[model samples]
Target chain A: MPYMDKRNAARLVNDYADMIMRIGLMYLKQTYDAEDICQEVFIKLMSAELTFEDREHEKAWIIRTTINTCKDRKKLAFYRYWSGEPKEELVSGDDFTGNDLLEEIKKLAKWQRVAIYLYYYEEYSTAEIAMLTGRTKSSVQKDLSRGRKFLKNILESEYGKDYGFEKGGADYAE
Target chain B: MQNREKIKKAFSGVHFSEMEKSLMTDRISEASLFAKERTGKNNMKMKRWQRVAMIVAGVLVLGGTVGAAAGTDMIRSWSNSFSDFKTAGKISQKASELGMNSFPDEIAGFEYSGGNTVHNTGEDEAGNSTGDWDELEAEYKNEDGKSIYISQSPVVEGKDDQQHTDEVVIDGTTVLYDCDEYLFLPPDMEGKTDQKLLDREASDDHFFISYGSDEPETKFFKNASFVIGDIRYLIFSYDEVSEDELISVVRELIQK
Candidate 1:
């Protein structure tokens, strides 16, 4: 029998498609690439036979696979060459547009964008972000800090010093 | 934090439409069917002549051998090998040169895109050219941009490892049908057993499967192989095309 039936696949898509697409966009910065990564992750999920201990374990697996797939896609020679051009022309079809903070986040380095997205948006700890991204805790901490500081500076310059940009409540240590 | 809320709000804009989600779900289900078909299959065997022919082709493509003993003349003669052609006239000329009867220009709705021919020479232990072989690979594309790849070579009698699930008689020739699953391992995981590879595929880090094959965008495929007279032909369709369509294409090739 097939590992994942249509009903099961539809359930997975309903549960994880949004998260996968968001993570893919944070790393890839393109809607089409994010869509491709989302589809690829679910396809891999269907073929996988590993049983998860809980819902968190399955979510972690999907997040990590999406990140790795995005990294692999960026490593391709075609993407490397394609990304070297002007950013304005490159992200013309990007979905995350018209938001000042999102534009600044998109301008950050790929690692910084990933760290920021996972830390703030997903509410993952620094250690958890490091685990998902295959980086050291200290490295992820640095990325988070640097990314946060960069976004804060942009916000402060745009909307005065009263705009609140503070440390998150998530535990950072392993 | 307000930053968290804003970040979530911004990222939330990036998501698939309902139609895309439904389409993707169907694709996943289809892929599952392919995987189920691949279960409980023995390793596909490579013929000795095919092995030698591939090694020669690999060496030639690499420009020269990197390591191994010197004074190895693996290739003695090659004619019009590794040449790409788009037209049927070119394919027929190459097939005739290889002493083959005929090759199809189009199959089903897919027109012949392009193909390459390879002529390989094998050497005996004494460094003398012993035998020569020829093989060709062709690609066809339909109006929907889907493709079918066909590979042809002379049939060599050897231990066949493919477990044919079904067979059909076309023009008195029995064609074997098999669903093949290829796990494209990372460079570090090469030469591992199939079970180990499957375990890795089932693991959380299963991104290695995407590293190979751009057309299908996946690792596994459904294929049909058959021997007609002295030549063996293998057809691969990367898209979710029907098995009957593939068989019909094979029938066209044999009849041609």
Candidate 2:
């Protein structure tokens, strides 16, 4: 739902802006324009008259706007993602710091990454993830199950076996 | 533990912080407050003289004065009324009676009736009570909240710097309402709106606001809207006139 007051709106914005920015940055990976996309998404939320059906709906709207803004930025001429082809032939590879883990996760197929992240980062139920991302509950489950396995393999390949299963089940163990 | 909680622990760094949430909320609040400015961009507004004539006229009624001319003859009296007052005591006395705002007199123009005001006029004073303007045709003004039409001038709001920003102070201490939402753009927008936005009988000073196109096409809409100021204004392409004409119109609106 649209917040009626400034204090509430400010509180919501402050909480979500970083998440939105990271979402935009996750897609385009251009730090210069990441903040612009974040601001634009909020403006879109206001312009489109998006209202929260509930607190959960509001959260989902922000995520959706962030994703749309990322897609919009990709339409710009200068913005093209590296194919992981060859580094020397690329324009500028100033790899933004602190995103190595995120980059690895980006290798996952689009739906898998979206399903994986929304589940792990937002702590949403498979049903709730489906609602947020506009996918089917079963699809979220499939993606989540696959995502877990992919992450397990990533940890094993990056480190070793003990570290993979140890941290892996630990999140589920708790 | 629930499956959701388990997944959450696996990825713990993406929590939305309290401060970030606050900023989004603030933007939404501000955006909604004046969300209509962009839409009103296409609507034509009344002109400078019409608006100035209205506010200067509005002040007259507020000050307990009766009727006053709204022409070049009364310009000084309308803007810097105190400067023409020889007796500071009388000015202070009027202030007490009206409790007029304490804004600098230099910024506020005044119109006194040489000791004759509607407040000072006797109730029995008949017919000629409205000074010389009693014979002129009355027009409606947005004076006093609700719109009222009068042949005689009433106290109306005025903006001396109507056409351009260099003439208006960044803080705009003299403007009747706050001006943060008004993003004055450079010349170039000629017919984005209509020609009716050009001609107006609104105020002594006129302001022309231009709407910038969504630079990157993806941003299809703009959000700033006017809440504090007049809703009527002129919008035209800056190219219609030569450099000389732009400055001339701006100067006339600024009354400099």
Candidate 3:
């Protein structure tokens, strides 16, 4: 029998819907597209007859599916035409509150943004992220490192807050 | 840690609405139906040699999307193991014999968009080998971005064992519901189901959804299969297109 009974799907939705949407928003930077990706992920889950070793495995599948869906949408011709220029109105509502730092993070490459979100926001270990994303552990760590370095430079230039140049900032960088 | 915490909090307030959840459920249900059409391929138990042969042939055919694996083919009629070259040839020849221009350029009021004319020989779900079956798909896009897709193909032989559930009588004609079993709204959502909105007048953006309080709720769009003579017809929509519209299209095709 399939694992995605009505009860199970609802539970999965309740648990991971927010996380999937957040990942989408971080990668796509648009609320409507993020929401669409969130729905597609759940729909993919319903049809994918995957046997997970544990709850952690299932959660990883959800995250990976969300990322893959976003990437596929980006491959489309229309997406290239429209998504090349960030639609400020599309990003401004509830998803983005015009936060300077968050906007800067959106400027990162998709892989870098995903690694940073998983490490800092979701608090997943680098090893866990490697398994989820099918990337080497070193690759995920490298993305995290590069992402932080980029964030540090941007924030220091804008706010004069030497994120790594300050006393406690170096510790946080590690 | 300070920067990390700030990054998390900066984007923490992103919210998904109740309406969004409902719509997601509805779309998921629709996707599940499309997935069910491939259930036959999923259930096939192929041997090692058959798997090897399928991979080689799939690479050569390179349709890319169809028949990549023994059971992953969504074309539905390619049920037989294509391990034999002669059998494959016979199937192709049979498919070549069917006339492709039988379907209308437009279905209902929607205009045809993308279509594929295919003649494929494969096996049925029961492991019975089939000959070349001609298939045509007509995708009609409405002004509202809702697509009305009609796929017409010759009925596969030995389909007598197929069972029908959720049979509904419309205009004295019985049509078999061809969607996922979980798609129908359970009892709890029935009250919330607006009968008026379920009709054809509703906008494409409107969807029928049942919120499951404890468990997951079931949501479905109108989907059904009907047979007119030797041809089998499948009609479905991703939006608020009504079952009546689909059945009417089927009726119109049968009349034609």
Candidate 4:
């Protein structure tokens, strides 16, 4: 059992650290804050009295804790945006875009931009996306549909033909 | 296929580091040591036993302890130890609410006094009702006559508040316990009068102990709390101290 060896715990943190950071960044929208959340999650993992059954259990705990930490942070009063960052900054939406879709989706609202990235780039099922990003399934469905339409319209205007836009849309789908 | 190619191409340029990994081997090794320090080898072996054998053996063993204690007075050894009675109440209720039905024999180091943080007498768990200790904290002067603040960490689901589970004694005049941080204190002999006396007079024979830990993320050595007047005396943890340094400092406090 992983509990038999406590270091398995820290090693667990080191392994999923990146995925956890990215998922948190998608929701939090700040690189530094996402890093802070990642560190806090690991510290919690290290200090926890819990002894897990195995690697799988530890990974699940970290991911779940990451989501819960994000939720907790949302409840807290301060977003404390770092000074000098543009309010309209775009987080990487590489997931849902080729050069064609990427250029188009950047025009969407900030939250909608990520909603599309999560849908197409990360390839999360609607339910998985909802869980990771803390949205209701209906909200996720709506956001994805809205994001898709926005991408569609933007591409249509640029390409002038449905052909280029249709190909980009296929790439953006679940 | 084309979409897959595009996303992968974007992913490649997203600029993550050459995947630098932390050299956490030392941390793991240190954690292994801590785990061992807490649960002795025999305790670990017992934890591995399956249910039926575990229960029967546990009963037989506890029954043996009862017969031994029937003749020995375990209570008389230390009459002055104090434990945190309030924390047990909150944890006990929460466990019941979750149907975990556990009194959580421990929440890490804040076990019974003398057990975890405060080194309180073990009997508090056996006694009466108290308020929630989840938010309880009090200010006290450590051996150096310096101010110190201690309290249980807050509750967030899935996180251990890092509260030393070992009992702490709050008589309201002075706070006493064996918290890991109890070993921490401010720079020497400030705002303290009597504590200096204790450090001076108590040095020769009273109990002297040292506990230290280093944070791997940043190199820092933290010492365990000191005992002055039979309480966890807060002293600076990371600073190096000669054998006589703290003793002399605490001796001055004990004087007043």
Candidate 5:
């Protein structure tokens, strides 16, 4: 399929490189593996005959491919004994805030983190998150609720009452 | 603010550095060549006349900017800079209407720090500009050298607050994760001994981490936000500050 010209293809990669890498990092935690998966996703996009009805369709396709590629990489024998190594470059650059919360999110079960990241950070609907993670809508909703409760406790214990860490009205609908 | 909202803010404020972006570009270029080869082979299947007709169609589309969507998307990335606002000391009428809160100079333990101009406008879902949302910001630092910066303003619903969800409490309270916003140091932090030490520590190769984003949207610190009492507060912290710590700082300030 003559999906996009070379310039357009390059633009797609440039526009989405960070998004793919972020999702990969959220999943893998290991930077190298995430980067590799990011590259593979773009390469797959390059080869796939993807026709988009709109930008959302194109973005969904990329994200879905990235998640699938990351899952495949996780299945590798190397991943079984994978030591979550911290890359030196990322820490040194030392940008972004709320690192402790990010650490806590990383500590979560993979499906939960993926669901939470998509649901909260990416601003995807629970239905959309369910589609992305291959889970039921109710399951995604439950993960968000459970994940929120789990994180609230961790944050409360970690920061203590000096910060007023209380369960916020506790309505977990969205 | 709810814990879910804090989690959302914490995750969204992540910034990817320029170095990391460059690496991603390199990888994309490499992938593009391989993609070109495969697509080129596919092109060979088309008859010459068909190829010619497609080229003409593409040319016509390019004239109207439809075919250059990639190019348009690329430009849109860099052009998404924050808009500047004219400063006013008195509260706007809109603030009164929204019942926004006024913030104290000290939060947790950090003092007021200023760098970037206050922003009063946020983008709507349709990418339209919504007006009359004003902001006030201050930076606070404790004796331990850790600092927090905060921006307070009325909640601008559906205006770039996509991270907002029903995770909000019944009181219409929610927190926003500003992954796209950066925190600049106040004019006073420059040349301070402890601040320099923190900068050195940041670059000392303790742990190298980079987010692979095409957009160069990274700064040297971390930040989070929440809305309470009809006011939205944005907080940025440096030197290994926890999200809980940041929230606590905001809690202390807002409670006052």
Candidate 6:
């Protein structure tokens, strides 16, 4: 018997499709590649013979797999050969193309972009982000701090000196 | 925080349409079904191979000449095995433990990044494992983000699988050059590729070719493989570096 039947697969897709898409976009910065990652992740979920302890466990598995798949896709020789040149426009979606904050986020390094997205958009803690990304907690904390500072400087400079971040956010050792 | 809300709102606007999601669901279902069938078939094939291997082993034991032939074949087959590593140090360590030549820290303008090792245990198509041999690889990257992959393995005994486009004699070693083509078919078009286009060979220079109505996209990469001493080395460039540059890189490795 198949591990995941069509109905179960459909349900999983429905539940996590948007989150997977957004994560893919943050890592890959391409709508087409992100869409491809979504399908690939679902296919993997359908074939894997894995049992989750709870909803959070399953969700964490999906998120980690999505990030790993994006990294693998980037490592592929053909992907590097063809899409090696950075595109002027990171994403094709009108929603992302016009967003000032996302534009600044895209300018950050790949790791920083992913860390910032998970910390802010997905509301994941730095420790959780580190576990999901297969990195040290301290490394994840550093990425979040540096990424946040970079975004703050750019946003404040462009918007206004009054454009400030909310005080008393997640505490970091640094 | 206001920043968190703004980030969430920005991302919420980006998502697949209902139609796209439905299409992806269908594709996943079909792929899983195909994979299940393939797994069943592979299991049956493995059982048959095991039975055949038992008979072969019995004959080899009775013949009394198995040791010499098996040892030679074991060394020859390690060129085909492959395993990935997270860092170049791991690859170098494996090579040192196996008494194989170590890869350089930097080649041409690319610095050492990460690589893999190839291992062969004299396993044939029927899946019998015996003896052991290993190969090493090192990946490099330049300032421009271009990649150069170099792998060294035991010299293969038979003809190569890829069709080589050119050959050059570098210091008594024959190096063969070829372009590797990979096709990316969108999920919606799974198993729908046109037979003719699918079989068509990729051109050397063309990076992207769009087939008007639901066809797979093609990407080509250039590489050079050659045998030096008892090791075969392959150099692959991800960018559009010229064939001469590839040969020059190989010449540099030979000098080292």
Q: Which segments of model 4 are wrong by more than 4 Å? A: A1-15, A43-62, A83-117, A131-134, A150-169, A172-174, B1-5, B8-20, B24-256
| Residue B249 lDDT, candidate 6, scale 0-100 | 83
Q: Compared with the true structure, what per-residue lDDT tens digits does model 6 show for residues B173-223?
A: 788776544454565554566666544523222222222213555545566
Cα lDDT tens digits, model 5, B1-256, are 5545665666544434555655555434432332123121111111111112222222100000001111111100000011121122222232344465544545566654332223222223332333433344344567787656555555443323133211322234454332222222332333442655456434432211122323433243344556665565666544467666766665575456
DockQ of 2: 0.11
Candidate 2: tens digits of C-alpha lDDT, residues B1-256: 4334433343333334453344335334533432122212211121112222323323221111122222211111112111222333444354345433111122112212222111211111121222221111112212222221111123433223324222222233232221111223222343453445444312212333333322311111111111113221121111122323333322332342
TM-score for each model:
0.51, 0.41, 0.56, 0.44, 0.44, 0.47
lDDT of each: 0.59, 0.38, 0.53, 0.37, 0.48, 0.58
lDDT of 1 at B58: 28
For model 5, the stretches where C-alpha displacement exceeds 4 angstroms are A2-5, A80-85, A91-97, A161-171, B1-5, B12-16, B30-256
**How high is the DockQ of candidate 5?**
0.10
Per candidate, native contacts kept equal 0.43, 0.28, 0.25, 0.14, 0.25, 0.42
Q: Pick the candidate with the highest DockQ.
A: 6
Q: On residues B1-256, what C-alpha lDDT tens digit does candidate 4 reach at each position?
A: 4544553454333322322223232223333333223221111111111111212222111000000011111110100012223354554454344332223232222132111121111111222111111222222233443322222222211111222213333332232222121221222222342575446423422122112222211112221223333223332222333323433433333332
Displacement of the residue B146 alpha carbon in candidate 6, Å: 30
lDDT of 4 by residue, A40-83 (tens): 56545543347779766666577678777766665655445442
Which parts of model 2 have CA positions greater than 4 angstroms off? A1-5, A29-32, A75-100, A161-174, B1-256
The residue-by-residue lDDT of candidate 2 on A94-162, one tens digit each, is 333213445556566666777666666765677876776677888877776676667667756775543
Reference contact recovery of candidate 6: 0.42
Selected candidate, larger TM-score, 1 vs 2: 1
Residues B70-137, model 3: lDDT tens digits: 43222222211122212323333433466322545565777655544433444334423333455654
Best by TM-score: 3
